[model samples]
Target chain A: QKEVEQDPGPLSVPEGAIVSLNCTYSNSAFQYFMWYRQYSRKGPELLMYTYSSGNKEDGRFTAQVDKSSKYISLFIRDSQPSDSATYLCATTTSGTYKYIFGTGTRLKVLA
Target chain B: SAVISQKPSRDICQRGTSLTIQCQVDSQVTMMFWYRQQPGQSLTLIATANQGSEATYESGFVIDKFPISRPNLTFSTLTVSNMSPEDSSIYLCSVALASSGNTIYFGEGSWLTVV
Candidate 1:
């Protein structure tokens, strides 16, 4: 099994709809969870990263990690067309610079 | 996030030719990394470029084919040697900042089209 797995979603949703993007990890050592947004032809920008577990809220975005289930999620509330992009989840273990990234889920929020 | 610049934003090269991609950061950093993203694939890490030392390459990646150079803290390069069509992809350079649990910062990327 891949260490980190995510559905490569070409998910389309109407604007103002809630969008949920998720990833599952098999490694128990992963402690840092991150969300990144990448637009076509552009580099990924870090959206948010949470240490440990639980939900972190920033504006209309929330990142939730359930270490027990090894699942993580990013929720976009009131999504806009500007929010259309690929969402990537990444994580790292103790004392390592190598972060395993999931195959990004492509999202399109249409107006 | 740290600011980064990559040269030759996009290029189309012929088979058997080599392309060297350059990365420069605004401030000094300790760790530099290279990643490749093929169409419809995740970002696969190629290597960690260490200043004044050899780069630590990942599995399926080799120094001969993906030679790396980290002459100083803020600069590094990756050369795709003797390229093939399969080598066409987006090449990105990243820096891991120690302060934020080594949060990675990436360059815009150099788009390579090997034909």
Candidate 2:
């Protein structure tokens, strides 16, 4: 199994809908979790960062990590068409630069 | 977050040719990484470029195929040698800033199309 697993969903939703993207990992050592958003032909951009098991909120975006279950999620409240992009989940242990990235979920928020 | 820039934003090269993508960071960073994203795929780490040392490549990636050069703290380059159609992908330069707690920032990416 891949160390990090995410559904590569071309999930479509209407604007203002709540969107949830999730990833699961088998490594217990992972302490740093991150969410990245990438548009067409562009590189991934950091959207949220969380350490260990907790929830972090940034405007309309929220990031949650569960170390016990080895699960991480990014919630987008009132998602917009501009939120149409690929969301990637990445994780790393403390003091490590190697980030294990998931397959990414492609979200399309329709107007 | 450090500002990262990559050159050759998009390119089309013939098969058997090579392309070198350059990465520049606004500030000095301890970790500069190279990543590749194929069409409709997620990012795959190519290698880690450490200043004043050779790059450490990931599994399935080799130095001969993707030679990396880190001349200084704020600059690095990755060359895709003997390119093929399979090599066509978006190459990105990423940096892990100190303040972001391992949050990596990526460049706009260098899109290459090998025909």
True contacts kept of each: 0.53, 0.68
N/CA/C clash count, model 2: 0
Per-candidate chain B TM: 0.98, 0.98
Interface RMSD of each: 0.8, 1.2
Q: With candidate 1 superimposed using the best TM-score fit, by how many Å does residue A31's alpha carbon deviate from the native? A: 0.9
Give per-residue lDDT, candidate 1, residue A76. Answer: 98
TM-score of each: 0.98, 0.96
DockQ of each: 0.75, 0.73
Write the residue-wise lDDT of candidate 2 on A1-111 in tens digits.
Answer: 899999999999999999999999999999999999988878888999899999999999999998989999999999999999999999999988788999899999999
lDDT of 2 at B85: 98
lDDT (0-100) at residue A70 of candidate 1? 96
Docking quality of model 2: it rates as: medium
Write the residue-wise lDDT of candidate 1 on B11-98 in tens digits. Answer: 9999999999999999999989999999988899999999999999999999999999999999999999999999999999999887
- Give the docking tier of candidate 1: medium
Q: Which regions in candidate 2 have their CA more than 4 angstroms from the true location?
A: none
